[model samples]
Target: MGEIKNRLRKDLTAAMKQRDDFAKSTIRMALAAIQYAEVAGDQARNLSEAEEIAIITKEQRSRTESAQTYADAGRPELAEKEAAEADFLTRYLPQPLSQDELVAIVDAQMAATEAELGAKPTMRQMGAVVKAVNEKVAGRADGKTVAGLVKARINS
Candidate 1:
């Protein structure tokens, strides 16, 4: 049902009715981003749930970065606005995996790979291992963080 996308649409309607300018604008931007991704390349197809989440996550990151830039440039007001938008996007994302949870996942994947290969997997196999771990992670953790953990687990 593309729950996130649908929810955003419904929320947009509610925001408009309530005259909530901030929410209305933010949700509109999010839905536009999602719609843009849906038609990004050849065919203009629908985005899966994961792809939709990824798109929104990327938007949230941009907002967060913009907030930092504004703060660094001595613009607290703009920074706060961007930060608020980023925080709003968080409502649609999966609850982030804690460090302990992520570490456990990395450890489990490495152990399973070792058992399958009849020896410990090396840094060379990190790609496959990371891919597997990312599938398990869904959209809960950042990819770079997952890769770093997998790298450390495989190395030591």
Candidate 2:
């Protein structure tokens, strides 16, 4: 099993022993999602750490969006629950990049791309830059944030 998968299992056991209903359920849901991903194709296989992280990130994003929707619909209780679940899941994710860090990464990637292509990337090359940045940052930053930064850097 992957390092992350082992940690999740351990944490789930702890949560269950401590009678943490929320944590237990949230961890269960995350494990289920990981299992689904493992069996998603023509064959069943264990997930790598990167794959596990991707699954957790997807779950966290879903919870965040659901919480926002619930809040906007005036369902504070449900929203709070979803937010709590998201916060719990975040424990398994890498810390998010700060605005400054993200900008620095974008600047570095842009410079490298410029050097490679012999010109600064145009808005037309935004996708390539964004892809490179996403690879560099992995799941530490949101795609929309990275895209926005890439767009601004390209235009400027």
Q: Write the per-residue lDDT of candidate 2 for residues 1-156, one digit (tens) a residue.
A: 788788889999999999999999999999999989999999999998878988999999999999999999999999999999999899999888999999999999999989999998898889999999998888999999999989988877
Clashes of 2: 0
Clash list (residue pairs), candidate 2: none
Give the winner by lDDT: 1
lDDT value, candidate 1, whole model: 0.94
Runs in model 2 with CA error above 4 Å? Answer: none
The residue pairs that clash in candidate 1, if any, are: none
Taking all chains together, the TM-score of candidate 2 against the true structure is 0.96
lDDT, model 1, position 14: 98
